[model samples]
Target: MKLWEIAHSRTGDKGNISNLSLIVYNMEDFKEVKEKITAEAVKKHFKDIVKGEVIRYELPQLGAFNFVMYDALGGGVTRSLSLDKHGKSLSSFLLNMEI
Candidate 1:
């Protein structure tokens, strides 16, 4: 199942980094999400786009995970050539991943 079925996303961008927050609708699904989705998994999933590093921060109290991806915006939005690869769009792409 795709993560989107059980959760939604919020995003933030700074420099060439993309901060994606995956928040589960129900806390019951948090355990599965935490186990299946790792920093390595996320980095691999967005390997082509994220060039630096992917760091995952657990927010279990909120049933969320915040992923900090570096060099992900093609050298920041102002420097990116690709029209479609913005930080905002990455979250949508992430939702496409099957867990």
Candidate 2:
């Protein structure tokens, strides 16, 4: 199943770094997500766009995980000519990940 079936996401960006938070609807879903969603997987999923590291933070109390991707914006919003410079669309892309 897709991750979106049990979770939602929020995205933010600063410079070339993008932050994406995946929040599960139920605490019961956290363990599965935590086990399957690794920083390496995320980095691989976005390898074409991201040039640096992917760091993941586990928030068990909140039933969420935050991923910080470096060098991911093509540049900053001001310098990037890409339509989605802030990388907001990445959240939706990530939600499509299989569990």
Candidate 3:
């Protein structure tokens, strides 16, 4: 199943960094997400666009994970020439990932 069915996302961006928070629909799903959604996996998933490292910050109590992606915006909103400079659509792309 796609992660979207079990999770939702919130996003923030500053300069070339994209902060994507993935919150599971239920606490029971935390283990599944934690196991499958590693920083390495995310980095591989977004490899084409992400030029820097992917860091995963765990929020176990909240059943959530926040991924900080560097060099993801092509540079930054104001500086990037890419169409989706803020990389907001990347959140939706991530939601479509299958477990």
Runs in model 2 deviating more than 4 A are none
The lowest-lDDT stretch of 10 consecutive residues in candidate 3 is 82-91
TM-score to true structure, per model: 0.95, 0.97, 0.96
lDDT tens digits, residues 6-99, model 2? 9999999999999999999999999999989999999999989999999999999999999999999988899889999888999999999999
Clashing pairs in 2: none
TM-score winner among the candidates? 2
Better of 1 and 3 by lDDT: 3
What is the C-alpha lDDT profile of model 3 across 44-84, one tens digit per residue? Answer: 99989999999999999999999999999988999999988
Q: How accurate locally, in lDDT, is each candidate?
A: 0.90, 0.95, 0.94
Candidate No. with top lDDT: 2
> Once all C-alphas are superposed, what RMSD does model 2 give against the true structure?
0.6
Error of 3 at 95 (Å): 0.7
lDDT of 3 at 41: 92
Model 3 residue pairs with clashes: none
**Alpha carbon deviation, residue 88, candidate 2 (Å):** 1.0
By TM-score rank, best first, the candidates go 2, 3, 1
Candidate 2 accuracy as lDDT = 0.95
